[model samples]
Target: MELITLLLLACALAMDSFAVSITAGLSLKQFNATTMSRISVTFALFQGLMPVIGWSLGTNFAAAISRYDHWIVFALLCFIGGKMIYDAIQQHEQAHCINIYSKRTICSLAIATSIDALAVGFTFSLLEVDIVFSAFIIGLMTFIFSFAGLTIGLKLGSIFQRKVEFIGGLLLIAIGTKVLITHLLT
Candidate 1:
């Protein structure tokens, strides 16, 4: 893939991380630079690493499923994206939980949000792309955007939290469609 495509993929992949960071910021009462940095770094690392791991797994099985890889990517992306959208639309009705920034919460959120990236990594293995460069771009973009998102959420309040998730869901679905279309045309 070209650098531009890699960058776009990174940005698309970071949407979830960015949204989660915003929620974290909204819940933070005693936020500090260190806390934000830790969140960003942890998220970025996981986001970057999951794809590498997925790609490795995909690479091993690439020859076995090369003919149907696009379909697989499309299916996984659609499932994940659709689920995110569904969750967002349904989330607002739930009662707000008490705000807490424990180690467990951070770890849980980071893992939960980065699950989609693992799938993306698998997709990367099927495509003609640069894994190292793409993963790096993804990690860097996620870190920067997530940090900014948290700051923005801190200032803006949690009223628009659902909006963030909605946008993320839209982006993922769009990306999925694009991947499928490109594969079809090729």
Candidate 2:
């Protein structure tokens, strides 16, 4: 992929990390660079790693699914994005005791949030893409966005957390739907 396209893809991939970071910031009593950095690094690493795993897996399955790759991407992104939107809407203001920094919590959250990227990585295998550059860019963008999201949560409070999640989820679903529609139309 070209630099611009890779960057755009990176931005798209980072939205989930950003949303989760915002939630973490809201839940924390106070935000610090150390906490933010930890969260960002975890997210960035997972987001970066998932695609590599997906790409590797895709390499094995590519020939079998080459014709349906776009649909697969669309389904995966939409499933994740739709779930986020639904959760944002359905979630009530309840006390969450799950500490974001705990290893167990972080691991689960990281995996849960980055599942879409796994599919993206798979899609990358079927396209004219640069795995190293795209993964690096996605990781970097996720880190930056996640850090900023923490700051935004700290400064703004939870006022926008649900709204942001809703928007991010909607954006992902829309992107997936668009891709599916375009592919089908063509």
Candidate 3:
């Protein structure tokens, strides 16, 4: 694919990570560089790596992957989002105890948000596109968007307070639903 086309694809793929990053950011009790870096890097890595993995898997497993990818994403996101909402509703000793900084939580969010990029990578394979270039672009775009998302979420959390997690949780579930609906429709 052309550079512009690849950039557009990257942007499209990064949308989920962007939103997820925002949700993760909403759970932050305070600003922490480690949290931002961890979230951004993990998300970028997953978003970046999934495409290559998909391209490598190529056409052999495309049907199998697509058949259940949406479900997996939906379940993962819903579970996490639900936890966030429930935790937000409950009394947290620290106001924000969602543990968005935990390795497991971050990985789950990253994987849930980046599954579609895997499908994109599969498409790249079929189109005989440069996997390296496209994957790099996707990763780079995800990093930028994820960081921006975190920043936005932080700002929003500061303004909204107390309900940021609730709203973020709703958004996460919505994103998951969107993926499920989109896949089903297609």
Candidate 4:
């Protein structure tokens, strides 16, 4: 793919991570640089690594991967999004307890958000694209977008407070649905 096309693809792939980062930011009581770094890096790493892994797997298994990748993504996002909504509603009093910083939570969110990128990597392999270059662009774009999303979400959450978590949860579900619909339609 052309560099411009690859960059655009990177942006497209990063949207989920962007949305999830926003949710993470919204759920936090305060912004911590270290925490943001961890979140962004984790997301970037997954977004970057998945494609390489997929490319390594190559076209031989693309059929197998594609058969269920969307479903996995949809399930993960829905589960996490539902949990966020439930927590927001059930523990409104203790809203600060949402642990967005935990390793497990971060990893889960990263994986959930980056699953499509795996498919993209497979596509790259089929198209004979340079996996290293494509993965780098994808990871870099995700890192930038994820960081920005978190920052913006923190500001929005601070202003909106109580409603932000619910909104964030809905955003996640929406992203997941979009992914599922796009894949099925295409």
TM-score of each: 0.88, 0.83, 0.64, 0.65
* lDDT tens digits by residue: candidate 2, 1-186: 457656656776787777677767777677578877988899899999998988888888888988997788788778777877886787645423447668778778778778888888887887646788788888999899889878876677666666766776777677677667877898
Q: Residue-wise lDDT of candidate 3 within 1-186, one digit each (tens)?
A: 558657655765666667566666787767888779879989999999998988887657546666676776677556656765775576544433446868998898889878867766765665567888888888999999888778877777533333545664565566567667876997
Tens-digit lDDT track of model 1 for 100-172: 3577766776777788888888888988567887788889998997898778767876666667667767777
Highest TM-score among the candidates is held by which one?
1
TM-score of 1: 0.88
The backbone clash count of each candidate, in order, is 0, 0, 0, 0
**Local accuracy by lDDT, each model:** 0.77, 0.77, 0.71, 0.72
- Which has the higher lDDT value, candidate number 1 or candidate number 3? 1
| Model 4, span 90-171: residue lDDT tens | 5344333446868997898899878777766766665567898888899999999888878977887533333444554565
Off by over 4 Å in 2: 1-5, 92-95, 177-186
Model 4: per-residue Cα lDDT at residue 129:
79
lDDT of 3 at 51: 88
Once fitted onto the true fold, the runs of candidate 3 whose alpha carbons sit more than 4 angstroms away are: 59-98, 158-186
Residue 88 in model 2: lDDT: 73
Rank candidates, TM-score, best first.
1, 2, 4, 3
Question: lDDT for model 1, on a 0 to 1 scale?
Answer: 0.77
